[model samples]
Target: MNYNGLFTHKLDALKEQGSYRHFLEVNKSAQHFPNFYYTNEEGVKRSAINWCSNDYLCMSTHEDVIAKLSFVSHRSGTGSSGTRNISGTTIYHRELENTLSNWHKKEAALLFNGAYQANTTTLKTLGKHIDNLVFISDECNHASIIEGIKSSGNEKRIFKHNDLIHLEEILQGINIDQPKIIVFESVYSMMGTIAPIKKIVALAKKYNALTYVDEVHAVGLYGNSGAGIVEQEHLEQEIDIVNGTLSKAIGVFGGYIAASNILIDFIRSFGTGFIFTTSLPPAVCAAATKSIQLIQRDDSLRKKFHENVLLLRKRMEENALPFSVNDSHITRIHIGNATQCKQLADDLLKIQGVYLQPINFPTVPIGNECLRIIVTSRHEPKHINHLVFSLKKLIYGDDTHNREIFSALSVADVENEA
Candidate 1:
């Protein structure tokens, strides 16, 4: 039936559209982070500065985090070996969940393979059991949340990104007694915009709707205790479901949902994504727990992380770089062309020894492709300056076309569109 030809045809189309995914192969020595060894196209291995790592505090590579991980691996070994219903639940698992619950001020917490699974499983389970359950989501919500809502096979409405008026309009149309959930991310990862949680919460209260917030990118980076945007906004108890990933700011591997005891139990009992799947490795969970503990114990890392964010933002502005206008750690340089986006990323890595993955279609719309530069506590000022210098050399020096496209994306208009 020429199945191979059919598969190739679709992949070929993606390549032509410059939307095909490409992964960078590199490894970072734990002690020396934001700097990693990557082989260039010429096969010569060179040290490169990392600009897009989700490890905001560099906790994953922290000596203490690694120490705990090693200690736990020696004590309990790796892999949980079974799903939670069977034998996967360990002391590490229980403690991490407990820590997460307390950190978010929720009555209970349930672990999932990743935040992706946590969202999909919980929403799908709720929809399956509740009658006339509908999901009202933000237009710019992460793919995981959207997939979760759609997988539930329930009616869904998407309000424009951060458009409280539109969200309220949708809520007003729904029956007062209907079971409704407003699903959104606390931090829109692409544009680095924050949701108006207070406004959203007020709307939810008025409409008798529950709030489900995905705090994957916010956890371990925001709030007094690093509980994420909800905690930062003092809306911890108000959010019905708070899904977070240990893989991001916590600098570990896994995801969990913090919620009321009844909701947690309900999802744990009926969520296929959580039930049948094997749990996270005990060592990883232990490491994640340790990382969070470290974060809560001190604000030094968070302070330094914000300092870097400010430095990067100031440099981008001083240089008149075309970037999204948002006061967040995420520094997005709007390039607006998929082909040029990939080319710019390629050039930066090959010519400048800086790694910033090209965020393209699906991750961001085609014309909205950008270089989502993320700053961490580990990034030095020299690295930041060099990154700006290299970007200027490639984007403004010789590439007139690149400059024109970026010039059109004025900071005001870019922020408005996003």
Candidate 2:
């Protein structure tokens, strides 16, 4: 049997398809954020502006967060050493869970290694234990949610993205007696569109289905206290489970689920992903807890982030650059072709010193390949204008084919699709 030949052939196929991924190694200096050093294709180290970081508030570099991490690490050493059930759980983890539960106004919270594990394990556990369990999911739900639902080996239906009517139709056909769950993400990461949280929760109530909302993208950036979309919509009480990640806006590393005490206790007891994995380090948990506390008290960070979002959008519009026009902070420039998407990103990084990772297939639909730019509070007006200028020149340059593709997309249509 030529096992090596089979493996090589598949990898070769991916490279031939222009879908092969190559990660750009970067060293983000503590002194300068949004600006980092990366080696170009020619092996020359260069500085570039970051536009793809999920650290929305720049809290990952915040002094308070760093202080907590330093203090906890110095006091407790490094690793958590084992799964939570064994010796991993600590006061840091417990306190963080308490903070998270209170922030979301939930009865309890259970920490997971990360949001990926939380979603994957919790959904799988729920589907397995609940009789006649079925999952109704958003078409564009994050890969984690999709994976968890798939692992459950239960009946599942995917409705059109953000189409409440489609979701309701699917729900109505299911036998009312069967246990069901509606799983979705609060913010559609790729498109920057917010889910219809209130409407979806209302439907879940009408259909008597459990509601699970992954608020990974919305958690540190929305609501008065940064709870999430559910909080913003006043539907926090309506959502059965809310999943969030600390690695993003919270600007640390970990994930947790906020829910009723009974539901949380059930998942905590049975979720294999949580049960089997080593818990997050005490220092990381402590830092995350501090970050959350700081963010909840201050709106300046999110306000500054939104200002940057608006500035970038306005700059792109003024230049007539093609990008997804959504109300959310995510700025997606549609490039359509995978090769072109990578090329644009490479050129921006190497030549213009603008760094935004290209969004390609399986992260997004093939024809929808684009640059998912994330503007943070650190990006100034000059940086935004420079990005827009570089993008305009590169995209609208002598490449008539690329120009035609960009011209064909109506910004209005993009917004409507969102």
Number of colliding residue pairs in model 2: 0
How do the predictions measure up, each by TM-score? 0.98, 0.97
| Clashing residue pair totals per candidate (backbone < 3 A) | 0, 0
Q: Which residue runs of candidate 2 sit more than 4 Å off their true CA positions?
A: 398-404, 416-418
lDDT of each: 0.89, 0.89
Compare the candidates by TM-score and give the number of the best one: 1
TM-score of 2: 0.97
Task: Write one digit per residue (lDDT tens) for candidate 2, span 1-418.
Answer: 9999999998888777677889989888756998999877788889999899999999999999999999999999889998998999999999999999999999999999789999999999998998779999999999999999999999999999999989999999998888999999888899898898889988998988999999999998888998888888888788999999999999899898999999999999999998988999999999999999999999899889988998888888888776777767888877778888887788777768999898888898887888999999888898898889888877787853446656667777665544
